[model samples]
Target: MKLLIEGGRRLQGRVRISGAKNSALVLIAASAISGGEVILDNVPKISDVLTQLEIVRAIGGRASWTGENTLCLDWSGPLEGELPYVHAKKLRASNLFLGALAARQKRVKIPLPGGCNIGSRPMDLHLKGFHLLGYQVSMKHGFIEARAGKIEGNRIYLDFPSVGATENIMMAAAGTPGITVIENAAREPEIVDLAGFLNAMGGRVRGAGTDVIKIEGVSEFRGARFSVIPDRIEAGTYLIAAGISGGEVTVENVITRHLQPVIAKLQDVGLDVAAGEDRITVRRRGDLLPTDVKTLPYPGFPTDLQSPMMALLSLARGTSIIVENVFENRFQVADELKRMGAKIRVKGQTAVIEGVERLYGTQVRATDLRAGAALLLAGLAAGGVTEILQAELIARGYEKVVEKLGALGAAVRVAGDESGEPGAKSV
Candidate 1:
């Protein structure tokens, strides 16, 4: 799919945020361990989430949408140990099923998952975590298989603070016989949300927003109702959209505390940002000032927002530097942005962005999810028309992106659809 964008219009008004995609995917997998009906609220209706539901149903589990944003999952039926690779290969989150199904079925065989090729996502850490939890793990024929004679818990130390490994290990440990401890665990807000959901479902998990996490195995789990946290990345994207267009806009349904890194960076770029309990407002004045950014783990500038920030920096007065510490090949968007009249140079994991007076809209392609967001924002601030190919890729992480952007007063729509009207045929 393609997105036809009209540039140079300031996007203003309020855009409500959706639930975190990263959190929802893992939480949906965690729901399978309950062995009964689990109700999840604030779930985003996106392609990735829908694919997860399909995978669950394909394996004999039942999942459906009870309401607009409510998902009801029941795993009472006998679930297969292996997920159909056809459905699993579409997303990286499919790997999460290993630990989830391992606990229920005692053995799991899942294919290597695929998603945005931001970097190398090795299964070594996750495999090691499973091994520490008394599961014999192996990879053969491009599939990961783990089996355990007796589910037991053990202490595991991750070489890096990998979020997937942490969540996978936590789920597997939650149903074991003993207590499992994870050192150097990921401290993202999504991790806390997952831990909260596990606890709500009668599992014992402690210390989620910290380096050390403790999971006390329980013999069984029951269905529970939980609400996922707001998507901070989505909120930050709209906040940057406001800054790039020199407009005053507010994003609601956001937790201010989860956006500290993004908020600080926008303020450094000469934007006025104010936080009220659960919403944030951003406004741009004169020319934006350049700032240095380094993408780190939680509590640092997020790598997911790095692309959109670069788009805003493209119009700054001076030069800005960005270092991506979380993922490799993240600079793939640099070449595409330069096609839109931005001066950006890439070297290894660092990118140097030189600001220009203005940008002219041109044809571009979305290399990945965040890269698509950067291009969309740039198109909003550029002059003339901007045609973005592979626009459907953005739907993997964002919900109602075109609808929300149109509501914010940006003229964007699906290419070659319905009288070229904004929000026409946008999926």
Candidate 2:
């Protein structure tokens, strides 16, 4: 797939944010624990999500799209054997089911998960947490097998604040027979959304969105409907797009509190951002000012938005330094932006970007999901046409990207798309 984008167009319009992909994936994986008819509303229509639904059906669970954006999951039938490796290996969230399946089934085998190659995302912390939950976990020959009978909850102190490990351990403890306390847990909003979903399904989880979380095992489960929170990453990407395009754009269906760090960072970059109850409007009229940024966990700048911010900073007035404390390979997009005539230098985990007055569009590749977004933003601001290959990777995260950008008056079109149609209609 290729994306042909014309440059120097100001994006001005309102774009509604989709459901959080991180939240939806884990919640769908966690839905396997209670074996009830779980209704997930506002589910993002993305490729990773479809892959998760395939895994659910492969494991003897029932999943169907009840609405355009609603998914119903029911896991009442008997499930056995290894998870389909073909589907599981395509998603990093597939490993989350190790804890969920371990709690429900005595033994289960699943392939090691895979996803964007942004960095090394090992499962050592997850396995350590599982061991504390009474499951013997091991990796052999590219596969992980966890086995235990009548799993019991216990205290787990993570070595780091890993969101996947925290969610996996929480799912493992949801159906056990005792209290499980997780120390140094991830303080992400998606964690809070998972806790809310578990409680709605009769699992007791407290203190999510904090460093400590408590999950008390329950014996009974029931069907419940829940809506996921808005995608803050997607909203942040669009906000940065507005700043880079020097336009006035409002993103709807977002939680302003969740965007505090991004909003502050954008203001530092010279974009005028206004926060409403459920929307944020970004306005920029002139050249942006360069500002330093660092990627951190919750309550700090998100690593997911680091690439898009780099794209915005490329057009800034001076030098900008970005310290990536999360993924080591997060600076991979710097090279792609440089192809568009941006001045960037990468050393280890830090990237020093020298803002240029203008960028000349050229061809680039999307190394990963966020990198795709960064390239798209650069294309919008470049002076000539920008061609981005592997545009399909962008749909794995963002939903209706071409259509959304087109609605905002961006001159972009898809070519050689997999779908018979010539746009992001598949999204």
Candidate 3:
């Protein structure tokens, strides 16, 4: 469905952020390995998470809603033949199942994952991690097929800090015999949350949210109640929404430290940010100024925010250079921003942006989840009406985006293409 956003209003409201998408995806995949039932709380009603859950059930796992924001999973049943690739290609998170399914079923076949046109995120690390755990991995017919007689724990070292690889190795090691140690592990909070959920289900895991992680394999696993951490990315998006729109907004249900990089960048752009126990407030008193930024792993400027920051920087007072060191193809949104009258140029991995006094609203398409958000923010801050297409991409990660923006006083609504009726409403 498409979205029509009328700009020229500063959004102001208290928005309670939902659970982390980065954490919830891996947590759901990890829960499938536990022999008993697993209950997840505070889960976001996102399309990608639902797709992952569908994949889990397609593999013979039983899933049911326990509450408005809770789901119960049972993964002890017999394995299905193969995962449906058409559904898997809808999002990249589907690749996470390679490790979980391989460990549980001993043999698994899944399609090559797809999501966001950001860049090429290879599965080499995931494949290598599985090989370390005594699995034979290969790709054929555009699918990843993995087989193992029995998973055996071993030392695995990741060349780069990859969140997907870390989660894959963690899931594979849960049922293997002996102990597995992963060096140079990803330090993202999502990794720790996944470990916490696995531990609650009788899996022995330690040292997450750090460079080193250790997992002790067990013969069987059970389940328990798990609550996902608040989404820092969502909080950061809301903070940006308030910043560029020149509004005062408070975002709740989040860990302040998780958003240090984002808060720092906002402050650099001349926005006032106040962090309390479990909430953050962003207020812009004057015009924003451009600030140079580089995308890195955790504790550094996240690559996920690169697109949105570009939108904010478009209205800055000076020129800003943003170097994307993580994903090679993350600058896909640069073209879409250009449609909205923003000046941006991409040279290889670096993006040089020139600040414009104001941007005029126009039609654009969302290339990815964060890119969709960046466009929406630009539309809200731009002059006149802005139409954003392929808005369903936003729902893959964030929950109730339009509704939240409406509550914050932004004139945003969904509309049909030729038909006047909008798509089905969802939170």
Best by TM-score: 1
- Cα lDDT for residue 158, candidate 1: 93
Q: Summarize candidate 1's per-residue lDDT along 312-385 as a digit string, tens digits.
A: 99999999999999999788889989999999999999999999998888999999989999999999999999
**lDDT tens digits by residue: candidate 2, 1-427:** 8898888989999999999999999989888877778889999999889999899989899999989899999988887557888998888999888877876765778899989999999989988977777777789999988887457889899988999999988887887789999999999999999999989988999999999999998877777889999999999999999998889999999999999999999999888989998999999967799899999989889999999999999989999999999999999899889888899999999999999999888999999989999999999999999999988789889988888887898878886554533234443
Using TM-score as the yardstick, the better of models 1 and 2 is: 1
True-structure RMSD for candidate 2: 1.9
Task: Choose 1 or 2, whichever is better by lDDT.
Answer: 1
* Candidate 1 pairs with clashing backbones: none
How far residue 254's Cα lies from its native spot in candidate 1, in Å, is 0.8
Flag the better candidate by TM-score, 2 or 3: 2
- The alpha-carbon lDDT assigned to residue 232 of candidate 3 equals 90
Deviation of model 2 at 26, angstroms: 0.5
Best by lDDT: 1
Candidate 3 lDDT over residue span 245-264, tens digit each: 99999999999989999999
